[model samples]
Target: MTGSRGPAAASAWIPLVVTVTLVQAVLALMSRALPLFGMPLTASSGMPPEAVGQLSSATSLGSMLFFLWGPALLVRLPSIRQLQLGCAVSAAAMLFCAAGRWEGLLIAAFGIGLGYGPSTPAGSDLLMRVTPKHLRATVFSIKQAGVPLGGLAAGLLLPAVAAFFGGVDAALVTAAVLALVAAAALGFWKGTVDDARPAASAASPFRHLLLAPVRLIGLLVHAPRLRLITAAGFCLGVAQGVLMGFFPVFLSDHAGWSLTAAGAAFAVLQGLGVGGRVVMGWMSDRLGDPVRALSGICLASGLTMALLASIGPGSSPLWVIVLSSLAGLTVVSWNGVFLTGLAEAAPEGRVGEITAGGTFVLFSGYVVCPLLMQAVIAATGGYAIGLILAGLAPAIAGLALMIGAGRRQR
Candidate 1:
């Protein structure tokens, strides 16, 4: 049993990992392009503070809709079919964004968010089924790193495309083309979907939320240490979202840096995030406790973020770049650790349910941060206070994890 099972598991897992990673990378690139598009709209339309908040909320709203509905649908559809459909929808959405109409762009953003939302949980499910217990953390981390890598690629390449083409629309069109190609590739890949149906006697999504394992993982996320992890993620998202959402404005308003330079800098952060995930994952696997590794990373990330905030507006651009890269590294590492921990915590057959539930909670941070941070900035008249508050969130989260670790030890 052991001999045959080991090789079989490896074959099954490797392809799924590769496909999901590619899909995530492509989606991240697409996501990076949206804020660049929105910044100009905010500038040109003379959008009010509230309008800015709404625009930011639109992405999260789209994600929320997907988060709410995706799990139910995952049970009904085959994983491959779901992925294929998601990629197709994402392709169409990107094309819509490329069309450059205001209504079209909004629709595209929402559609893309909805499409991408299912891919993670669904992919995670697939990974869990195929990967052996011992290798789960390593494989999951490698897969999740694709997010940052994609974001990095988008950050670096999209702006250059926009510069050469002389408009954001061209970059959007390029992204659409890339997504379409990815979808095409996925369509041709051969694999069985990991379709673990909920028992016939199961309750609805809300009811499932109350199930023992699901509730345990959910509480785990809200646990003091995990709460800090989520909060750090929230702050990271805010910093990242703001930079992606409005770095052009920052460049134009405060720094003499051009749009291209600012965009590249933003991309650098995303690129570094890939390395962060790998380092964090390796540490988690070797240290034999994901929670502790996550806490350490968050602490490092929090300190870096505070340092970044302390670098005043007119400070050296090099300092901003350095801090941003460090923040990206530490901030993005938490996802892999947390997700793996949640999966590990689940009861056997309920892995899918627990993972999906945990992801729903984590994504809430993504949904809420952009809009909330923007609102705070609008109210406060300066980003300094907002950034400072954001920086502290991760530190608190890390401390929570330390306390939890101590409790578990005792």
Candidate 2:
């Protein structure tokens, strides 16, 4: 077993994780607030749905660009420095978002995406470099939990801030200020950690990502188990986007829950996801095969979501709460296992590239799922079909992972 280290070494990562988590949470809340901000812009300026989609996609596009190029750039720079740069960029993006102009919003989205995009792979690399392999899964789970934890924070806090302040713009500005503070903290943080060495001299980010090794890794990421896990992530993203996107409508029209209640419920659901992530990660570590743990969680989550859909509107408040909590737990629990597996499977010296490649593919699911869910809802006149379809996708993903795990065992 890898022995435990000194407190100074272990505690080194605490501040970084906390800052990243807070940034992510604030960004997510801001992202959710975009539609509200966009409504007036769309109504007055006649902005096309496609343009709105572009604005939404800007962050992902920036992330894609960063992931494709960041590995090589970061190889030369210290991980802490890279994180600081990312934080600065993210802060600037938020400032632009606060400007409240349509063009500014788009630019801000792109900036934020580019700035924060490298955090995932960069952070993962740092954790791997410092933490022992045996504890890697658990550490990663704790780190990954930040995503849901941030979501929960946004769910609970942003709405309250917005409500109290009389608009989301004020809340966004406040979030931006916080991001700036985090960036400052990152910039000044002093920690001693080894840096990853690159295999070759730097090349164009686009070229590096398209090369054989990276492409091969990207293809490998589609292995049955990984594919299923990624698909589950996609489904979860869809559920998140749609549930949050149309939440007010759902509450008023179907559930008869007030906007305040809906907001509170959404916060609770996201908060529960934090626990889910930790539990799933711990279980995966103890079970010795993260894939199996992932499969179980995905299967359970999918079925529970389906049941929630079946119950429909006007279900008991208690049932709604229970279903939402279960869904949160299962849906958000897959990332640690999936990501840790990807990190482990990567080529000896190309872990960053492999991680970037894998995450790029996985995030594609996020882009597609929401659009599909909305289309289904529009066509069917309710979320029932969409929810059922979403449920099945994860189950299929679970089966794929089970097969992949079997193959590995052999």
Q: Best-fitting candidate, measured by TM-score?
A: 1
RMSD of 2: 4.1
Encode model 2's per-residue lDDT on 185-277: one tens digit a residue.
656544444333334556676575456446645556556544554555554454444444444344444577754566666667667777777
Q: What's the C-alpha lDDT at position 105 in model 1?
A: 61
Clashing pairs in 2: none
- Predictions in order: lDDT: 0.65, 0.63
Evaluated at residue 52, the lDDT of candidate 1 is 43
What are the models' TM-scores?
0.85, 0.82
Point out where model 2 deviates above 4 Å. 1-58, 73-75, 95-107, 194-256, 310-313, 406-410
State in Å the error of residue 248, model 2.
5.9
Q: What is the lDDT of residue 139 in candidate 1?
A: 76
What are the RMSDs of all candidates, in order?
3.8, 4.1
